[model samples]
Target: MQSNAQTPDQYIEELPEDRKIAISNLRKVILENLPEGFQETMSYGMIGYVVPHSLYPSGYHCTPNLPLPFLSIASQKNFIAVYNMLVYSDPTINEWFVNEYTKYSKAKLDMGKSCIRFKKLDQIPFDLIGELASKVTVDEWINIYEAQLKR
Candidate 1:
């Protein structure tokens, strides 16, 4: 697949203040800890980072773009979301995420196949979200994808 023309700086620059800050902070956390080779681009009108198809030809199959996203973040009309496919595969992880998120149950949750949604930066658990991001290292992602393949 061809690389996206949209650069991270350019993408963030076009965002509104609230979204920009949210995306910027999330991007900061991701870049600081995520492994290199991950690329950010505009996908479906939201900010998405993934390993290119060049690296994972079958697609971060488990991730949005296939073979890339262990983590994904997005800005929507009503919320910001972070998706972790691994959580869906692990009951323990989902349970723990729910438990951790209960501290703010009043916040809305927009869950998709693998996305978690929240309205504000404060609604997200910075430390716990970071922890969730950390859970998906390269080895873990391959293992998770391999396990999914068997299913």
Candidate 2:
């Protein structure tokens, strides 16, 4: 579900008590491990980590006015979702994440193209997510994003 909150802090504050901690922890890990050049902001009605326009003036292809989104964390209707563009855009990263997920949690990976869903909050793998956030640099993501656009 999308949020109407204007800031990341506000978004977290509005979540149900059951979800507040999990989403907060997820946000903590992402912000701590996310590489420099990526800025945290409220994006697409979720807490988003993006490559700001100062670095990539083209912004997103679909929404050119907005910054290039790299990752986002949202509390969905039934689960908390981590939307990671690196896993969606790069096959190597996707393969690595899929393989590594098994090492972190016993629960089956509930995932979409880029959205990793955690129905059981206790099973969320914070470290794996953090490492994934660190795997791609701003330059790399921009390159990968541009390449995909050309295809």
Candidate 3:
């Protein structure tokens, strides 16, 4: 389920009290590790990391008016979710993330093509998440998105 929050702080404020700490920690990790040029905003009613128009004027391919998405954090009804587009666009990165998460985590990873679901705060490995967030540079993401357009 999406939130109605217009800003990151608002989103955090609206989250259930139990979920706030984990979300805040994850947001901190994302902000600290994310490459320069990716701005944090509320997109799709979730906390989003994006390459703003200044860096990529084309915006998102599916929705040209919006900034190009990089990653997003959401509080779902059943669990917390993290969507990383870089993992979806690049197979090698995807493979590395999956392998590393599995290797490092005690619990089985609950993940989809791009979204990683966490049933509890401890389910998330902050180091691995940070690596995934830092892996793709802005130029790399733009290149990947542009290449997808050609396909």
Provide TM-scores for the models. Answer: 0.75, 0.98, 0.96
Candidate 2: residue 105 lDDT (0-100): 100
lDDT of model 2 at position 124: 97
Poorest stretch of ten by lDDT in candidate 2: 84-93
- Report the Cα lDDT for candidate 2: 0.95
Better of 2 and 3 by TM-score: 2
- Whole-model Cα lDDT of every candidate shown, in order: 0.68, 0.95, 0.89
Question: Could you tell me the TM-score of candidate 3?
Answer: 0.96
Residues 75-142 of candidate 2 have per-residue lDDT tens digits of 99999999999899899999999999999999999999999999999999999999999998899999
- Model 1 agreement with the true structure over 38-102: per-residue lDDT tens digits: 66666544566665777666675444454455676766668778877768776777787777776
In model 3, what are the clashing residue pairs, if there are any?
Answer: none
**True-structure RMSD for candidate 3:** 0.9
Give me the candidate number with maximum TM-score. Answer: 2
Flag regions of model 1 displaced more than 4 Å.
1-5, 35-45, 51-57, 62-66, 103-110
Which residue pairs clash in candidate 2? none
- Backbone clash numbers for all candidates listed: 7, 0, 0
Q: Cα RMSD (Å) between model 2 and the true structure?
A: 0.6
Colliding pairs, model 1: 59-66, 59-67, 60-66, 60-67, 60-68, 61-66, 61-67
